[model samples]
Target: MKNGKSPGSDNIPVEIVKVGRHRVIELLRIAFNKCLEEQTIPEIWNCAIVILLHKKEGTGEKAGSDHVRKTNEWLRHQSKVTDVIKRVARLKWEWVGHMARKTDTWSKRLLEWRPWGEKRPRGRPQMRWDDDIRQIAGTRWLQVAQSRDEWRSLKEAYTQVVETG
Candidate 1:
């Protein structure tokens, strides 16, 4: 729904939709209702197009020159694009720290809640939400997060580590 984003597999740009907002909304509404009634979605809706743009340095280099072709990793390193996983991890850490500081919120309660009747079915225990935090701030991460100043420092350290790593 956001403008300036790449079009989906349908190749319909958001700008076009915006131009015909009322008609588009009505058409989409009918389509959604029909899909729900039939319990079926259009096949094209499941398709996506992923396009990766070359970085400035990567683009300037000749395709068939003597110079070595830059790998995707090298190009990503040189580009300003942020890593999605790193950003998500940083956001998750910040959210966990924020929730940890709350006294009696549902969010905090749910965050600390554990399932009652789960049995092991794997070779190793799955990684947890607070695992990274525990690794960085020790077992007392929640206690550390309680203090505003301490939590801010911890967040900065976490951000630096995520960005670099």
Candidate 2:
């Protein structure tokens, strides 16, 4: 319903509906009734506008396709694909933490393993999977993820972060 938002497959912007909700509802009712009688959804519903984005690094700007922006502009404003990616990432981290807590020899070894005495190259150290996990889930994530309900709630928190930030 925000201004300057692009229309979906329906080609109807939320602003139009916002200004004339009753009339829009009536028109939608007719269209939906016809669709129901024909037992077919509109092909427009499947349409998505693809936009290409150029790569721009070190500018602190998001450089990618417009899918994320378009998804955030929907009528219902559902979560974008990035949110799913974040949720999956958090779940994988939780799974790893859960496995690390296991009493098995392999799990214990993995939890305690470290690289030999080798000097790292200059500049920023190479990013590790554990670093990304800690960045998203915090240092106490392992303890929080131990409980099923707590992990689920943590995932929800991550979901909100993904959606808003």
Separate clash counts for every candidate: 0, 0
- What is the alpha-carbon lDDT for the whole of candidate 2? 0.62
TM-score of each: 0.49, 0.42
lDDT of 1 by residue, 1-165 (tens): 579998776788999989997787667666765665565888977776666855444444567454456775574464433455566666777788789988898998897788899887768889876776887788888888888788777776776666666
Off by over 4 Å in 2: 1-69, 72-83, 159-165
Residues 84-140, model 2: lDDT tens digits: 445455666567767756765787577657889988899988877666556666876
Prediction 2 TM-score vs. true? 0.42
Best by lDDT: 1
The lDDT per prediction is 0.72, 0.62
